[model samples]
Target: MATDQELELIHDPAYVNAVRLAGKGKLPKEKAGNFGIGTEDTPIFPGMHEASALLVGGTLQAVDYVMTGKSQHALNLGGGLHHGFRGKASGFCIYNDSSVAIKYLQEKYHARVLYVDTDAHHGDGVQWSFYDDPEVCTLSIHETGRYLFPGTGNINERGQGKGYGYSFNIPVDAFTEDDSWLESYTTAFTEIVEFFKPDVILTQNGADSHYFDPLTHLSATMRIYREIPRLAHKLAHQYCEGRWVAVGGGGYDIWRVVPRAWSMLWMEMSSNPTPTGPLSPEWLDTWQPDSPVTLPQSWDDPEGIYEPIPRRPEITEKNTLTVEKLLYPIRSNQSSSVKPT
Candidate 1:
């Protein structure tokens, strides 16, 4: 479990205490609104303090394994609660595990960290946590928060103070398909990793951008999920000497999307070949009855699973422009390196 001192790495002390009291019924529910508790998103449940701390603990343990050289890469599927703020919880997240882990990496190992977020919603809490810290560079690629929850993560929300240009956001348009989504992610990731050259990399892989997710509007397919980890794996080796920590986030379609997407991530981490063809009969039989939707038959989504999106050209063009803008600073630096004749 995460201790109060450890939690203070990112959360306020009073907010932490409030959660503890509220969990034990010492704090009144009516007063919990100020702390962002007892709401529809972050409901006040029994043992909430411990439950939240365990999520933090899972990510911290992943950090411990990587920092100690026990593992080159670590993953905690229960973590990546990036919407939790220093004093308040939102978006069903109580503690920002990635925020706390990034802070711990800086303090304990003195490592320069690169955080990549691919959740459908913006990672507002994590971005604001390290907004002015030069050592931590955060890159978030999400569906634009124009109408989404936590409404943030625009292209202009770079960094502040000494950390300017260190924080990058590329909010793609809704109805973004596999190719357009992957293009934004790959271009930004490649450029930023080369520019920052961080000592370690942490990725928040939220699978809610898929077409099946009920909460978000992005129309990404399983193809993007496969490529997401593939690029991260390759770059971690190239720049950070294989130091990578991955965590899960924002996958409400627990039956169909989350399992396959996350399984691919673990496969990439362990250097196993990506699976293809149909899923195991035993695996399907066990969960099929309880699943609300029909489980997929193969490792990849079938052809024509979603109808062709209308205005595809317009959406793709808009996303490409957003990526170019996000990478403008780096691109300009590259141009300056040309050295006039």
Candidate 2:
């Protein structure tokens, strides 16, 4: 578990104390809102601090494995609480593990980090934490905040001062299908890594963008999940010399979408051939009894699982435009630096 001091690397000391008190049921009810506790999204429960800190510790451990050369890659499926703030918690995230781990990477390893967040919601806390620091670059591709919670991550909210142009946000429109989603993610991630040339790559792999997820409106399938890790794995080797750490983020469809998505992630990370047949009967039998919905029989989502979207073309066009605009400055800078002799 992470020590209190370690958590304070990204969280405020007073706010960390508040979470501890709230976890033990010692916090005053009136003061709970000051720290964003006792809310519907992040209600205080017994051992909340320990639970949150344990996730942070998991991400830190992943960082250690990669930076120390014990492993080329590490994953903490419980980490990636990106909505956590320095002084508050939002969107059911108590402690921001990605933020804390990035800080740890910089302080301990002195690594220039590139953070890529693919959760359906914006990675607001992690972005804001390093918004003014040029050494850390944050890129988030999420459902447009116009209809989502913590409505931020617009293209205009680039970094500030010396960090300007380092923060990239591609807020794709709602109901975006697999093709558009992958286009945005693939293009932005590839270009950003080339520009930043980071020492290490940290990815927040939230599986909530699938059509089955209740919280988000995107219509991505298992195809995107398969490819997301494939690109991250490739780029880790190509750019960061195989230094990659991945963490979980927002996936509300735990029964069907999350398991398959995360399993594919691990398979790709470990260099296993992608499985294409029915899921294991033993695995299905273990969890099917408690699931309210029928679990998927296959590893990939069935074709036409959802109704055909009428706005598919428009949505794709808009998403393409957004990515183009977000990358315009970087592309411009790259072009201008070329010698024409």
Candidate 3:
């Protein structure tokens, strides 16, 4: 479901060659700067293609597993390179793997797909790729591009003509807390899935947006991130007859954050809820063994999904009114008006 060999599919010949050149282990003066080939974030190390390919290959296999009905849902934690464009790469992604997978699904299985991204960063590459596409509905939630990298997923950037309104962007703020965030995401996703009703769901679950992530300032706990996979699974079962493909986008804290968040994701997909806050020994052995962070016996209990709906009606109304007032100008009925009864 994701890939780096998409040179023929999405990349310019020149840019693909540039990536290839960078892989050769030498660099021109601007090579490191322009290609992001050698930087603190995306160091152009040897086997760049291989490491990226592992992600892609794993994702593609997941797609097959889901398509074949072996599993109702599948996820690729290392996938979701949304920053890579058709002719160029940016934002730490060399190849737009999510787009590549979407195209593949269209071509091979003729599957109608809905791609939703909740990364702190906009899914610019994926959105732009499918801008004029009617078959794909792209929805994203993130800090408004004005404050983030690759700034593009504004509210009005809907798909064109037949694709109009099929695309939606809900940009929150850098400091937006969890309760408000998940409420918006759940509302939008529920509405969109009910309307478009695609054959499959492809979600970009990026842990980079979490509070612990070094890259983005957005605040999301492990529980919110964990809820995403669970929600994706539930939605797939509800709307798509249990067909789902998940791709990882931006989780940079390679040692501390990314693996734990993603492990919870895997647990969600597998329908096993491990006690939160402590990494299970089973998980630790898989992700780390030698390092000091050899995955804990159990993951620390996350704050847990925010209390979007208060237990009491009066309190729920109060929260709803607050959202209705603050978010009305921006989302209007799309969010605030849809308060749960």
lDDT of 3 at 205: 85
Task: Write one digit per residue (lDDT tens) for candidate 2, span 61-139.
Answer: 9999999999999999999999999999898999999999999999999999999999999999999999999999999
Better of 1 and 2 by lDDT: 2
* TM-score, structure 3 vs. true: 0.79
If scored against the real structure, what TM-score would every candidate get?
A: 0.98, 0.99, 0.79
lDDT of each: 0.93, 0.95, 0.73
Q: Using lDDT, rank the candidates from best to worst.
A: 2, 1, 3
lDDT of 1 at 226: 88
Tell me the tens digit of each residue's lDDT in model 1 across 4-122: 88899999999999999989988887779999998999988889999999989999999999989999999999999999999998989988999999999999999999999999989
Error of 1 at 57 (Å): 1.0
Which candidate, 1 or 3, has the higher TM-score?
A: 1
The candidate scoring highest on TM-score is 2
Please list all clashing residue pairs in model 1, or write none if there are none: none
Which residue runs does candidate 2 get wrong by more than 4 Å? none
